[model samples]
Target: MAPTESQHFGVNMSSLEFARSVFGEEEDIGRSLTRGSIPGDMESVTLDSSTPWRLKDLELPPEPIMPLLIEAYFSRFHWYILLFHEPSFWNKTYKVYCQPTWRRRDLSDVVTVLIVAALGLQSVLQDSTWHGHNTFRIHHINHRQLLLDLVSEVRFHLIDLLANPRIEAVQVCTLLSCFYMFHSSPGLAWSTSGMAVRAAYALALHTKAPASQDRIAAQIRYRCWNHITVGDSFVTMIYGRPASVDAAFADLHELEHTDDLTIPPVLLDLTGFSECGDITSKVTFHQMKFRLYYIIRQALNRFRLLRPSQPNTNDDLVAISQEIKDVEASLAQWCQELPSLYNFEDWSLADRWAQLEYSLQNRPADIQEHAEVILLQAAMIQLLYDGAVILTHRPLLKYQVKPMRFSGSVIDSMQKSLDAVIGAALRISSFPVHKFEKHFVVSIVFHYLFMAGVILCIIPTSQPLTNTAQEAKAGVVRIIHASRAMAQHNRISRQTDKLLTELLKIAVQRETLAALDNTSVTGYHGDEAEPPLLDSEMSTTKDVPLEGPKELLQANTTTIYQPDLHREFSMDLPELLQSYHHTLDTGAARNELSDQSLLPSALLPLDPHSVFVSEQLDDIFGSLQSFYS
Candidate 1:
């Protein structure tokens, strides 16, 4: 009745393949991160302006209301795009509005303002914390229609501006991409960004313009190009696509100083006065993320996806070993080098706003202006930093694919990846479920968590699952729970959460099947079906303290999982996972999970023969046998 080694790996392949397929299908890893279009199921956005409106016909809010929208964009949304000079933009806006005349050539600035207003209003509307937007949330102003009208107007002039290839067009394109990113339209964002980058190329923003251009004008060009690069490199990196920026030209015009702008323009990147009335020397969110992502993109390119080296070669293992050490060392160095304003290393694993609370309390007076902006940006930077660390060593997930008995060097490298990737994923899943509801959740945070969740599903969790495997599975559960909580609001989040939950259920059930080969399926009836623990081999798996659902390790055999000696999950997720496991074991995969809204109709049914599809056992089991030998 003992399960054969083939059967053991059969279970492994089925779950791993499902994990691969979930992200593989719109699920579209076959090409890149395939984002789904706005599903019909998305809460139907009510648009009041059904009829088409022209660019000049699209009216801005009244003159008095202009400042609030601009403030909303600068304070709530500017950090994400970093496209405008606050003072200069406002000055131009007043001039355009006061003159009451439009030049065919001068509509670019108007369009840029239009996009910013849309994004700013959207951010304010989406985030419950921003009470200022509530007053304008009158029944008459359909924010969605207003947003649509503005975007439609911008589009009318966008082609002409791009045809001419102006800096204003590039700015408009950059900000527009951000608007698309939030609206569940990354495909549009991606295509629009390509246009933005290509237009920048046309303007030759990659390299310095000749002395014929004014000094201030040249600086603004560098600043605009910098924004485009942020979007291009970031989107491409996360999407598993190629870089759109011309690196060859970027080096020719490697400019260090981007013209700084503050929310108040006087607080230039938060280095000047504040609500506290003190000249605080703070690094702006834009400056920090701009620098952070540049470094992260470089690390990702050099180490993982971009420049792939052979995984089977001895020389490659040695090289990877070196890279592993460098990655770990660099993470520490990067954290140390961060300015105190954005230093979030301590809060990386903590709950939302924890660092912000401590930080604000320690500052002069009770609080400072724009503190929330700093808080949101720091959290994002943390996620990006951690996500990059995981991808840097993601290839090592292959080590788990077959549970290799690797060389000492290979073991060291594989363990480092496990520690880094799972550790990062664990930290990401550690954020409270409420994080999904916030405006900060925009900018591909959901995708990053989904990426991590898929990796968690791949990590080895054999009998007497190692602490690392327990933590990995625990991390997966937390993500499913969080995403599921937000599923109703976000269609992508809902679908991903359900799929991952089903995948985890299947994974757990497969392990159970592997352990219960002697038990008959018909005998799996009601409460009596919970199989006894295989205690004969318990000592090894029991060496570590239980950090998650103890039921998952019911079979205490020798583990394939290599537990990280470092961290453990301190969150309450494990206990909930324990209850969730009980539901699974109690013939409740159908009823209990659905009752909890954890699984929907899409939950793959558990047929007796459907447990493990051995067919996917192609070369997926991987061949490091030569290395193992």
Candidate 2:
């Protein structure tokens, strides 16, 4: 029989067809472009031909504010080092503005500087303090509006900037991508990053420079290409989409090194001798970071290709499992090979906590730089490592087999993955919330926390809880608190805080109910003479009907409460836990619960009728949509 349209697509085709054919025709597709939606025919989209080149209308910050903004960019957004030769640009821009001919500078360079300045101001205002007598205040609202207006002025000339693509144009697109990410617009970031990648490829930035080119200029091109590649890989991972730059086409040349008592002349001239060594070190560090991300991108691509539309055969499942393990091994080796400067081995929790406290109360210039630069780098390395581990083991959660035949090793791997995620979260929690909030992407942090919550929910049913479980729960709570703190400044963090709260409650309830079941079973069996089997054995036995108190039914209902996304977490726990006992008297209800091994347990097979299983998968995939859309 042919499947109904609704059955196959989960929507009424007639309604879709009517909407697409009728109402869609009445709508102006050009207006959708203005609303930031892509059109079906890219060539048909209209551009405003009459928009003036109003570069003079662009406002420049007062002299003091200009330096502050530039400082903020360098202090906070260090990842963009490769995109621009900061010292040279800073000096050049300062000199230009100091003279009368600043307005005569290339419009593209002016727009690029404005983009960076606006982002820098946003970062500063997001993390600044205003002292009014006895009060300290953060003035983000007004500053954000100012930043938006600046961004709008640049957006007004976006087409003009891209019209004559050059190195500066690529920088503009890359900076714009970073700006979108700062505002939690991953979709825009992905799009803009792709544009930058394409622009870089057009300029052959991914190929080795011609011998005729200046060596310093060639080195700069190398850095820019890798920057684009790294940015593309990051967005691809977040969106679970294909990358813009083809790996085979990329130039994988390592930075040239020479043993000398003195630095290169080009480096000395670009950034004074005092800062040359630091610049070289940062470039090398970024190169290493890019390599790690490259590995992750390869793994993500393989996983996407291996994803099955239907249940896999035994051999396919084994292959997928081995593939994941191999990736994990590669990730382990990457971490092992990291340079000592990027390593986090020597930083103790106590030391980080101390630094964090100092950062929150006082932002001394030196300490603040240390926290933002060194500590942030270490945190990022750990975050990426943990994220890779999660991605590596996440597939096992969906790989289903008979419960009796399920391998304990998979469960063990998941446990370790969760532990690593929680450990990373704890490390991040030690950073100053305001600084961390500005520097880190909230969605990524939320992803890690959500993954941890899912693992926490399942572990109790799959195996006994341990001290590691308690530590993991505490880590979740700590990260939730950090998210809440950030929610004050960032809208995305507010959404993340709400989601984490819900997931934490669900995890707590699952653990609580599992404990209750174990207790009730022990008490019930103690009253009889038969020897009690292990809890793991009993939970896995399909033929054994283990008896428990009637209250277990009530607990099950409360544990798996229907999640209402719009509702707050205000339900009465004890009452909800006790209200469903009346249903236990019905034999059909009891049999249904028994046949399914309880209605909402995560340990059950992936049955369509299982509410918890379906909801869990939906929640995981739904969170993923935030990155792509």
Top-lDDT candidate index: 1
Q: On residues 1-629, what C-alpha lDDT tens digit does candidate 1 reach at each position?
A: 01111121223333333555566645543223212121222211121123332365686665545567667777656555555666677777546644565555455666777777777776666555665555566434666677788788887778766755567878888877877765748788888888888877666676556678766566667778777777777787755577787554443223343344333333323321232232232335555566666766566556544343444454555665676566667667777666644655544435425544554564543134455555566677777778777766764444212212345666556556666777788888775446435553453677777777766754432321334545566777777777867776665577568666755654454333222321222134455554454564342123322232232334223222332211112112234245445645664432322222110111122454433323322122211121112
RMSD of each: 17.9, 14.5
Model 2 scores what on Cα lDDT? 0.53
Candidate 2 per-residue lDDT over residues 340-439, each given as its tens digit = 5456553443464355445445544543454346545655666667667656655544444332222445445534544554455455544344445555
lDDT of 1 at 94: 45
Give the TM-score (vs. native) of candidate 1: 0.64
Span of 10 residues, lowest total lDDT, candidate 1:
594-603
Local error of candidate 2 at residue 453 (angstroms): 5.3
Which portions of model 2 miss their true places by more than 4 Å? 1-53, 79-81, 93-105, 130-142, 250-280, 307-310, 349-372, 400-465, 517-629
